[model samples]
Structure formats: C-alpha cells, structure tokens
Target: MATARHARPKELENASLEEIMDRYVARYADRRADWAAFEDAKIEGYKRAQHRFIGAGGSGKHNDVSAIPAGNFTLSIMYVPPGQGNAAHTHEVEEVFFVLQGHLDVFVQDEDGRKISKRLGPWECISCPAGVIHGYDNNSLEPVYFQVMLGRGKPETMGYADDDLYKRRDEHLKAVS
Candidate 1:
C-alpha cells in the first residue's frame, strides 16, 4: 500500500540523491530562518497547540512549517543543547530520525519496560515503531541536531509520557548517578 507519487513539484518532489541535494541547497538559499520549517497544521484541540515541525539547521532557533498539512507524515528538526533533550513520549505512528550533526544519545523502552540507551553519530538513523515509548537525551558536550520524520493520518494523536518520566525518576537518577 506504499505508492510513491510520480509528478510532485520540483521543490517538493522526491528525487534522486543529487536532485534532492540540489533542491535542499536551493531551498536553503533564500530561506532566512536560523533553522528550517518542514510542515504544520491548524486544529482545534483541548490545548490548542499549533502542529508545526522544523528541519534541522541551527543551535536553538527553528523555523517551523505550519502552512501545509503533513498528510500522514510529520517531519521535524530536533535540536538539544549539551544537557537538554526531549521528554519521553509516543505517537500513534512510527518515526524515523536522521542525525544531521553532532551526536545524540537516544533512550527508549525495552520489552520489559527497561530503558535502552544508544549513542548515534552523524549520518546515522534511528527508527521508533508505533506505540513505543521513547525519548532522546543529549549527553554530549556539543549540541545535537537531527531530523525526525513520522507517519501521520488525517486524525493524528500525539501523547506524551512526561508523567512516566517523573515516575521513572529513580531509574534516571540511577543512570546519572
């Protein structure tokens, strides 16, 4: 059921390696944001948060894209300072991350609900299956930047496990200690 589109616009077209690189360079030329914006959607939710994702580029600043719908897929650029990273969360869809710069220490839940941590370097990629509880922690001295792509449906739900993170604070302390 995975059919690729044939005639996408040159800008949005999924192209070969060289062509994609060309498009990226051209797109980056006139763009002025410290980081890149990939996609966004407007919706009426319980908390009313704008659904926007950015492409990997800067240290802390990001240019989020919200003008277009992700259409079953979401892409975002995640940047974490030396010691800062995202909290544990899970989505209804699978996600794939490509490391663009620096290194990232990713933490995810195992079958027995244990945390599995892995350090990935540039050009490496990681995948989080749907319904998996996972998050990333930046333990490197330098900032870590990566691009995240997730599958999305028309009605998508994003769930965070912040409470679970706190609940596992004892495990966290043990890891850091």
Candidate 2:
C-alpha cells in the first residue's frame, strides 16, 4: 500500500499527463531478466530470475536505469523454477510476495530456527514485515511467477540469515556487472 510520504521522481514531479503515463507504465515485455540476482540465487535451492519492473526490488540493481524510478517502494516479478527458491532473509522494510502462477511455499522463521510455511496458490499473497526472516520456494512440479514489492525505493539489500551467504551478499552485483 502506498503512503502519504511518497517521493516522486524529479522527472515526474511536473511532467505532462501524457509524459507521466508514458514514463510510469511498466510492461511485462520490457522487464529486465536477471538470474543470479541475489547471493543465494547462486546456490542450488535459490536459483531464480528477477525481472525488474520498478527499481530493482531488493536485488541490489539500484542503478537499473531501465526501470521506472521508484518512489518509496520497489517492485519486481520473480520467475522461480521448480525446486528453486531463495534463502531466508530480513530487510529494513516490509516485503510483499503475491503469487501470480503456480504454488509457492512461503515461510517465516523464528529466532530459534523453526520456520512456519504456507502454500500460496495463484492470486494469494503474504506480506513479511520488516526484520522478519522469510522467503519462498517453488516446491511444486512447475515453475512459478510472483510479484515482489519492497517498502523502499533504494533500500539496503536483504540480510541473509546464513552467515556465509550474508558475507557474500554483494557478490551478486559483481557477478551480474
């Protein structure tokens, strides 16, 4: 949900209605496909492609000029293959996962390492609050497509719960660049 504290990009602050519509629109055909978007995406269980829409979500591709300049939030469409998902991660702002296709197993973990998961089918969604350890998996026999939204336009990248992965969090940027 958008808030009253939104910050409009400079280009949109005083643009004509036509220009605003043109620049603000994000089309599925124009999404940027980035596999290996996060540190865990380099691991077997976390292999998925991040299709950038608004900003780069939490993928750390902050300079992705092709994306619409975000205002207080970011959005991306994730393409998760069967048997793949992401490592548990926490962020400074809330993150929403809305399933668009296929079944996804979304989970949030306790400090003691226990995790609770629920299966989300098409049109289902979950909003993981800030600082919560959470992630999702495509445990079904097919691939899955879901939309992810972060509560900040240029927020810090995710904090992985796994020490090794956390240490190499910025490596994804190096690999992609």
Against the reference, the lDDT scores of all candidates come to 0.52, 0.90
- The RMSD of every model to the true structure, in order and in angstroms, is 11.8, 4.0
Error of 2 at 18 (Å): 3.8
lDDT of 2 by residue, 122-166 (tens): 999999999999999999999999999999999798999999988
Give the Å error, residue 174, model 2.
Answer: 2.5
Q: Candidate 1: which stretches are off by over 4 Å? A: 1-68, 110-113, 153-157, 164-177
Instruction: Give lDDT: candidate 2, residue 129.
Output: 99
Estimate the overall C-alpha local distance difference test score of candidate 1. Answer: 0.52
What is the per-residue lDDT of model 1 for residues 66-132, given as tens digits with 9 covering 90 to 100?
Answer: 2133345655556556765655567666777688889888778854668989999999988988778
Best by lDDT: 2
